[model samples]
Target: MKKLLTLSLSFVLASTLFIGTANFAHAAKAPAQPAVSAVAKTVKQSKSYSMILSALAQNDVIGQFDPTEITANEVGALINKVTQENPQVLYYKSANVWSNGKIEFAYSLPADVMKKNRVALDAKVKKVVASINKPGLSELDKVKAVHDYLVLNTEYDYANLQKNTIPADSYTAHGALLGGVAVCDGYTKAAQLLLNKLGIENHYVIGQIGDGLHSWNQVKLNDNYYFMDVTWNDPVPNRPGIIAYDYFLVTSNQLRKDHSWIEKNWAVATDKRYSYLQTGKTAAK
Candidate 1:
């Protein structure tokens, strides 16, 4: 009886051990990762301006600009100039004109109209442009130039903040340069226009950030991508002036920390440093 009992006990213990080992092996196999969708996947692995333009065009968000109206040689020259000086002032003509002898670009508005509306913004852009000397710059330099210009010239107006009143399309470079005050959309639009003239492919990204609607820019440089937020970079009203560099040249993950973009329109970035910002603090792992 004792020998039979010992044998039976040994068998039971062996079976339990085998079952435990099998369960461990099963657990060790990784859970199947969720598949990324075609739309959700990034178009370019890096943050180049061309790649950014391609992505924007693919998404159908960039507003229609008559390609024929833009001269190729002029565009090339502008790009070269921007890459060299990182100028705050950009050349603008109502219609395309190639000749270089004292070109006077005309606007129908009265001489004092800009002064009455937002004179400071105009002055600032002009001053910055005159100061910049770089041309044919990389996308990163373009972003930095705009970012610095905005920071130096603008201030956030909390009292004027309205959900729907912010004008996006009308904010010209002259306006932003002079007043140093504009809605998020205004800041972004002006940046887009200036960058476009420089032959840098940039997109005016409209999305939600925190509890408010916001507009920003995404630029491509050297086959890589980065985000720029001129509005957020500006100092808050009635505060010691400080520019927020957090949004400058940041990845999508870093932006997710304080801002949330639409899933369909969000541009994925190759830089992984900010990826943790996307998923809350859980990304710490």
Candidate 2:
């Protein structure tokens, strides 16, 4: 019997595949295997993660490799790591892992559509980064600029989320950057793309918010890690010209009040110096 494991991480476009292993939340709710633990776990298996990433980067739709007898959970972790690392590879969504080490990916959009969206997304990302990541801007400043830009521009896809009619692009950075609407996944991916362009160190986080699935980002500033959730900062109902910094550059303890994640595949964020609320920077602004 071939075991088929379907990994769904709170994405808007998630669908139920044949029952096999774990069932993760969609992007609306977003991630919680604690950020620090997620990073630690993935590090131990970095070799396998790198190999899978290399193949995906080559745009190979389906590939086979010896992952050295990984279980369903490990397969899920590996796929999540790759997705987190390469947010630009937004076309690929879910991974279909077989017992024999054969891996197939299900794309969120068709090839032709993805190609067009990729071009548009890349152009938009370049423009946005150039505008926000100005010369001599400190890392914190750059992160804030991108965070505010995203919140001010993109509106959460409440309509689709409520109607269960979410568009494929709404789950990717392309939607957040170009379409002006997205879910948490889209927001996180867009942040990842912008930060990568700015040369800021960051990682994508997959976890949960009180039993609900969600996705976010953790960024490195002056060697200290901090969590950022761009989606939560961007209010629903399409509020324009308002940016919420509640979750901006926050520590794990601060975020843990409402957000919970697995403690296996990410970095523990404890720095509070850059937290917008910690220094009362929001009050001054």
Candidate 3:
């Protein structure tokens, strides 16, 4: 009778342990999946030269700075002309057009500057591009996806801004993701680059905000313009304890209060119907 009782007690103890293990497994949380929008699409891989030409052609005035007018030497200097033998990327310099003697087209990095920063920038671009599985995404959705990703990944590094070593435009998406910190300009430019890759229309606006120079983005979504400030959305790096969204999705008036921009820098819509918020106040006739 004592031996029978011992066996029964052992079986009860084993049953209790098994029940505890099942409860713990059920309570564990799963990893969060990336929240992709309906509009996200995959980016097509293009040859280096093709990508450069495509960017140039898509610019507002390619005819003004005709490629044909440029000499072979100038073309070679401006474009690396990627070949099998020379796998390394090349830098291109801005040239003068017939009418506008020294027209500054798109921004260019000097050969030395490119050489110094190329490795860092390339690694950053590759990583950020690889993060999203952009397949069959619409233009508007692509912009939103990038905007969301930036806000979620990067935090504002106010100390970096204080040092003035890193600007808002300097941070690429990859850097922001890996480092979790960036200045305002870096946040804006990184978002712009990724959105452009997805064929979304966006503009980088640099201007004075309050007393200091600042940078932000104006993206065209569904035929309307909306402002996004990723830097302000992320947590302040030095003060990670706090998070702010004062500037995430702001209206023109709100932006105008703190940010004054040169009219030429922005592609202001003529109709005013495309403005994000209407106050019933019209521009001077």
Candidate 4:
């Protein structure tokens, strides 16, 4: 985790590949995070990852930025990183073109589709944030509040996705937060946004399950960091109001049973203080 701290944005910039939790459906564990002084500074400086993310948060293509601070390639990386880190960044799907120092991102939803859905999406996020923003909520309490809301609200959207019909931008936060029906990508991205909003540090985890790509979130709660795969907890074909702590908070050793990601890509999950079952407050199912 110290290695992660050395990097700008607290290793916030990484390829966090997210796939539907179909293949690795029955998986779970979680951990906590270190302090946020370093990350807070990075966010304050308008660092590369957060900078490009802020640009796309407006729900538009990339326009301008300080060249010296962010490169075209990094812009592409930021698109994915931001999508995983901030759920509000449900606008563009992926980086379309990054040439001549001018980066243009592709939209997950077409202009017309975005126009119709943007208002509703914004309203939903606002409402959720308000509910999660109550005073006296501890960082962990806030994290749980956001996590429960996501698993309760979102279901793995297999039908539209398998049909290749884009009812909403399932590839981004809009799909997860607004539609309440997203696969792993949607669940992971939604948690990323909510956790960050609650002031908890987090980053995306991209890895492979079998032959397919998959993604989930690694959150930093106070001085201890852990992992949370909201997608894995919310069962597929989801029964409403059934939230599982199976994957609520576990260490990397616990997660290795079913998940794999490039170790060099992000911070290692070593903290076990917040692991759901380990804590004794939540019994293992």
Candidate number of the best TM-score: 2
**Superposition-based RMSD of candidate 4 using all C-alpha atoms, in angstroms:** 8.4
| Candidate 4 local lDDT, 125-208, one digit each (tens) | 778989989988888888788888887777766566455453435555667887776756667777777676667788767665
Provide backbone clash counts, one per model: 33, 37, 16, 16
For each candidate in the order shown, give its overall lDDT on alpha carbons: 0.42, 0.70, 0.43, 0.59
- Tens-place lDDT per residue, model 3, 178-279, is 466655545776777776666667666555544444557777766766666656545433333333344444556656754566645455533343234333
Best model per lDDT = 2
TM-score for each candidate, following the candidate numbering: 0.48, 0.79, 0.49, 0.72
TM-score of 1: 0.48
- Local error of candidate 4 at residue 206 (angstroms): 1.8
lDDT of 2 by residue, 6-103 (tens): 55532335421111011212344232221233355445666667666765654456755455646655666566556667878765656677777777
Q: Pick the winner on lDDT between candidates 3 and 4.
A: 4
Error of 1 at 144 (Å): 0.9
Worst 10 residues of 1 by lDDT: 9-18
Candidates in order: C-alpha RMSD to true structure: 24.4, 6.3, 24.7, 8.4
CA lDDT of 207 in candidate 2?
A: 70
